[model samples]
Target: MPEPYEERTGRRQTGPFAGQTKSPTDRDGRAVTFEAGAKQPGYVPPLSDHLSPNQAHLGSTSAASQPSAEDYLQMGIDKHEKSQGDEELSESAHYFRKAAEGGSAAGCVFYGLALRHGWGVQRDEKQAFGWLEMGCATVMQKPSTDIVDLDRRQSLMPMGTQNKLSAEVIMAIYEVGNCFEHAWGVPGTKRNQPNHQMAAMYYRLGAEQGDRDNQEHLANLLSQGKYGLKKDMWEAAFWYRAAIDNGLSPIGLSWVYKVRLLANQIRAGWP
Candidate 1:
């Protein structure tokens, strides 16, 4: 300390405990600062460890045609049937049971579903899982291969089209389609089933959410006075306008060319 401060510049030091200067430099004499919280380039953190904005929105996607669980299981059954068309009941039971045991509630439901339809064997609800319901809930709950396929197909979405939509919206649109088309598993009862009234309700819900398909179905139903709904041309035209807003170019043409032409011909012939 009694000498000048320049005397401490070039002193050679040895051993682990020999360093005494406040400045710590590397061999290149460059001072480096090590930060603990810094992130490296292209680091994708785990889902549980760090959820990004994109990862957080995984469950929110709107689907136009959400296939039911029964639909899925029936597809598998169809494949099996096409492969082994001449197989006996006992032989086919193995295929259905295999699908059932592998967590496809649809598979379980369809074992009963096939029995109900007497596809491969005698109709026996007693022989199947009577309580296992598929489609509406199971399709939404499980991690299905069908859903995974849909995910892969939708991976390359344009940036402007990706929006966070709720599962309820998807289910509602699916219900609307089933009601309009009289799809399988939609209740066939006169009071509660896919009648015009039910179709109208589902269509309104889906249309309010900006689905043009629903708008078109609703318009068609209104135009024809089907499903016990009153005939109202003005109301029908309003729904067509909504469909037009949602990119219904072909739908617009069909309404103009086919339906209107048929209606005009029918009116001309009405004596």
Candidate 2:
């Protein structure tokens, strides 16, 4: 239960409406009283027998057929917060499925998690894998650089297929990778492989497409030979140099260059 506003604030809300009555109290530990049956505007409409058409329009799905992704996510969060019983958990799964079908990437991810854990859904690794795959692929198909301009000096991306990708989308790709690797909601499986390999792949794709963070991560991978990847000294040097030239980090690249030189010297002497 939340603390009543009156209890928290030293001042208390006195009466009902405008010009009806108003007063401020300095009193401590007094329960603030309100006029009985005072009505206010901005009522939160009940979850209608179904969602409104507007919500469906935003989601590209029929409101009657499914709750929007936002609503379902809220429902899941609410239930989780309340530590609800099994019944609520089941309801959460149902809503998550509806939202996922409506193309909510978040919904797909959560539903996949539920399927993996048998929480509010039957434990089904195959289904979970499919949902996880979809979520990852959705972002991969459209890199964030295609959506938004992160540099504040630059203008926003045009509102069409050519639009730049938003930072949100890039972050989502990273999160999806975390999900696959960490088994957050879904179980760790081949679909959700571990250790940054999948992350590296996605980051490389994003970097190649001009996402700054992806570019940086890809550079580090090349420079350090991450994930047991074969270290190509020249290729590594090239990427590090490219990143530095792109205004990423000159110092980091310099360090990598030094290491590359040392590695070459060792190789030349080995014969």
Candidate 3:
């Protein structure tokens, strides 16, 4: 019902990042260094939002070495964080694009966001939604183990990779639901505008994965019977309770209690 983001506010939504690192290389192409816990001039947002601590470890890059998918993603983070102006930000987006092309799910998510907000790039809501969806569209499969190989190695996934896969999926899912709920980047015209049905579907997917914000969103929708759902106050209470336990906003404590009470009373004589 409301105008899309680019249409609503005159400007774009801005926010992205999680980490600190030595500049990697200086003018002479020598390694640069930073003091631990010291905030350098022109500090920027961190990679915390998109990456777990394990995944956010500082990475090094040099002109001579080829960058991997992860490297591209990290380079983008560094650029985005330390960017002095649109030029650097644009460079950051370029790296994110390369990361995505090189098969980084987190890369897809960040690049999608950049497109969505016109961060360092031109705004294109449709493409933003596409990249976001692609980030979560497929389950990251372990490379098939050769039947000839013997051992537990086949089933084991690196913790960092696992964490990256999980966090990125949840991030992409939440963003998708948020887009649907707000009509930010969903496809189509009238058929695509702020559809609560689609939003609820995506929220439930993340809520079931223990995403606090998703749980809250789903709970609100259930409580109000939005999206063609029958008002199920008990279910609403259930999700709100889950959200509370999961933390994040720590929202709806009192409201959840009242809703549970109201649900108990309403259902008491029904069955």
The superposed Cα distance between candidate 2 and the true structure at residue 258, in angstroms, equals: 9.8
Q: Pick the candidate with the highest lDDT.
A: 3
Colliding pairs, model 3: 17-46, 17-47, 18-46, 18-47, 18-48, 19-47
Error of 3 at 7 (Å): 17
Alpha-carbon RMSD to native, per candidate: 28.7, 17.6, 12.5
Best TM-score among the predictions, by candidate number = 3
- Compared with the true structure, the alpha-carbon lDDT of candidate 1 equals 0.41
Cα TM-score per model = 0.34, 0.42, 0.65
Runs in model 2 deviating more than 4 A are 1-66, 122-126, 136-139, 142-162, 166-172, 179-197, 205-228, 231-271
What would the per-residue lDDT of candidate 2 be over residues 59-141, giving only the tens digit for each residue? 23334554666676667545533433456667767877876776666566656656654555666666775675565555344
Model 3 stretches with alpha carbons more than 4 Å out = 1-65, 140-165, 190-192, 227-231, 249-252, 258-271
The model with the greater TM-score, 1 or 2, is 2
Candidate 2 lDDT for residue 119? 51
Question: Which residue pairs in model 1 clash with each other?
Answer: 69-135
Q: Write the per-residue lDDT of candidate 3 for residues 1-271, one digit (tens) a residue.
A: 1123334443323433222233322211223345798544344344455443333543344464678888888889888877866678789999999988877778888899778766678877889988887777665333221323313332223334434336567767767776776677666634245555566667776777777767877777677665444577777778888877776354435666776777788889744
How many steric clashes between backbone atoms does each model show?
Answer: 1, 10, 6
Error of 1 at 226 (Å): 1.6
Distance from true location, Cα of 68 in model 1, Å: 17
